[model samples]
Target: MRYVFFNHQGRAVLGVRTADGVKVLGEETLESLLERGVDLVTYGANAQGPSVEIGEQDYLPLMRKPGKIICVGLNYADHTKESPYAQPDYPTLFPRFNSSLTAHNKPLVRPKVSDTLDYEGEMAVILKSGGRHIPKDQALEHVAGYALFNEGSVRDYQFKSPQWTVGKNFDDTGAFGPDLVTADELPAGGKGLLLETRVNGKIVQSANTQDMLFDVATVISTLSEAVTLQAGDVIVSGTPAGVGFGMNPKVYLKPGDVVEVSIEGIGKLVNPVIDEA
Candidate 1:
């Protein structure tokens, strides 16, 4: 089942996608429901609340506040080739704070400090349960669902130092939802799906999940070895080639540009670019 968090009457409400409209689950957010071990399959079976027209409500990030947002860099072979750094055997990971997250249809803030705001379209895996030292083979069992992410970057700040935290954690730069497509709805580990990014109606990045250097299973297993993977922890599976930084004439986002990140089965996450006030 697809799940979403939306603003209704100035309050955040959790809802499940239905054939007619979005079925209201409760006022509790997605993270809260997951924490409570709410059985999504049966939670709203006898719904008595009002259904909201999908496009009429304002969207919120799938999880308003995730415990952690772990991002993998250079996990795609094609992207690694376009990058300046040499491909490494291990996944290059980074942390993105919840402050950076924006919802689908929200505006991505392009900070005034630089005009090099770039986009990294990737698939995000949301964990259903918490665990540590998880085995690679069983990692898929922990995934709750999959969603799309636009790992928007402030290129200038990113390269300011070896650490990418500064650029990656800018408020409202990252766009992360529409709905979370349950893991069962897609292929195992979200593999074999087509992931693409389009900027203002033109395709910029295109690749298959199978092309990822380190698949979802490996990432989960590896990450779990060091940190306890918790429910609501998001793992952004990295982007493919064709980012603005990798282009001949850098094509950074400008005010009024619309960026759409689409993953097969999950759906498209669209956001507009706006100058920071």
Candidate 2:
């Protein structure tokens, strides 16, 4: 089942995609529903509501205030080779603040502080349930659905220090969702799906889910070993090579450029660029 969490006419509402159109599931945010222990898989598929045609939803983040946004940096091998860091055996992980998230159809701001704005398109896994040290084999069952993410970065600030949080946490840089496609609608653990990133109508990065060194299950299992993964947590899987800074000529995002992140089963997340005022 596919679900869209959006703002319609100024009020937040949840909708489930149906044959008739988008069915108004309820006004409750996905975050609240999950915190209340609603089984999204069963609830989203079975819940019925009045059919509504939402032409252009003012999209919201998959989770308005996701408890944690754990991000993996070098899951894609090629991306690592293109970077200055040497490939490591373990996943290169980081944290993103909730304030950094933006929604689909929103404009990603190119900060006035730097012109080196870069885009890293990736898939974000939303968790329904989790616990400490959850086994890798059982990790996939904890997933609720999947969404797209544009892991936008400020290149100069990113390399300012060995740590990445400063550059990665610039507000409104992470373009998140148009919809959250439930797990039952796709291959298990989101495997074998095509993930592509485009800038200004040009294909800049392309790869497959199968290319990820650390898949969903592994990342979840690995993360669970450290902290408890809650119902509303988000894990942003890393992107492939071909980022602006990695290019020889270095093509960074500028004002008026449109960026898109498309995944095979999930959907495409599109955002326009704007200069910070």
Candidate 3:
């Protein structure tokens, strides 16, 4: 089942999408509910709250301030070739602060310091439970669900240094959410799914989840060996090729552009571009 969690009346309103409409589940982030041992996949079958129409209001960060936001870079071989860096033997991971996150349908701000805002349409998984030294075979058990993300980057700032934190962490750049599709609804490890990205109704990046050099199971297992993975941590699987920065003219986002990232079995995450005021 698919579920949309947005903020309403200072409440973390979570609702499951049904044939009738969106039926409210509770006023808590999905991560929090999973931490409390609530079974989201099956609980909504009978249990539910009032139905409400949620709009783009309070900024919903999907996991809602999830403890860890781990991002993988250059996971796709084709994307790695387009990138300045070489393909890595292991996953290249990065971190994102909560301030950088924006909700679905929200505006992706182009900061005044630089106008090289680039989009990396990606798929991310939220952890239900986490632990250290997790084996690859059992990693999928920890995934709560999957969501779409526009990992907006300020290219000029990003290439200024080897470390990508500054360019990647600008406030209100990362677009997340729309809905969380439970793991059971999709193929194992989110494989065999087509991930396509579009800008202003034009297709840009397109690839399948199976093309990742480091898949979900491997990323989780590898990360666990070094750091303790906690419940609510999100692992954003990297984007495919066709980022504007890789283009000959190096296209960048400006005001009035709409960016969309859609994955099969999941839903579309769209955001309009606007200059930082």
Candidate 4:
């Protein structure tokens, strides 16, 4: 079932999209629902007031807040080729602080500090529960679901400094949602779908998840070995090539540009670019 976080009567709540419209999930966002141990069924009510419309409600980040946000870099062979260094044998991981998470359809601000803000369309896996030293075979079992991920980046900061934190963990930069879908509802793991990115309706990046250097299962398993995976933590797999920095002329985002990231069977997430005011 498709689920989204929407604002209702001055508060954020989870809603399920149905033939009747959005059925209010509960008094709070999905993160709250899980925290209170509320039955998922309780969120569904029978035709309350006029059913609220999707996109009409103010959106909160799918989880609102997560204990940790882990990300992988150059997990795609194509992205590695674009980098200025040699590819590593293992995943190059980084921590994207909670401050980076943003809701879908929101304006992604290009901070005055960085001039080369770029977009990296990616697929992310959300952990449903906590597990440590999780085996590779059981990694997929722990996933709650998937979401469309737009890894908005500051290329100048990323390449200028050795550590990626300054470039990656910017405020309201990481975009995930429309909704968090259950893993059972999607195709098995990593071999099923095409993920693409478009800027202002023009395709800038296109590739299949099957091309990922380290598939979902491998990423989860590897990361779990180092850190305990929690219920709301997100693991952004990686993005394909065709990033602005990789282009011949090096295209970057400007005010009023709309960026779209889509995954088959998951959903699409679009964000507009705005100057820091």
Candidate number of the best lDDT? 1
Model 1: ten consecutive residues of lowest lDDT: 39-48
Worst 10 residues of 3 by lDDT: 55-64
Q: How does each model score on lDDT?
A: 0.90, 0.89, 0.89, 0.80
Q: Rank order by lDDT, top first?
A: 1, 2, 3, 4
Position 239, candidate 1: lDDT: 97
Off by over 4 Å in 4: 33-50
Please give the lDDT score at residue 92 for candidate 1: 98
Q: Would you list the clashing residue pairs of candidate 3?
A: none
lDDT over C-alpha atoms for residue 133 of model 1? 96
Q: Number of backbone collisions per candidate, in order?
A: 0, 0, 0, 1
lDDT of 1 at 259: 97
User: What local lDDT does model 2 show for residue 98?
Assistant: 87
Q: Candidate 1: TM-score?
A: 0.97
TM-score of each: 0.97, 0.97, 0.96, 0.92
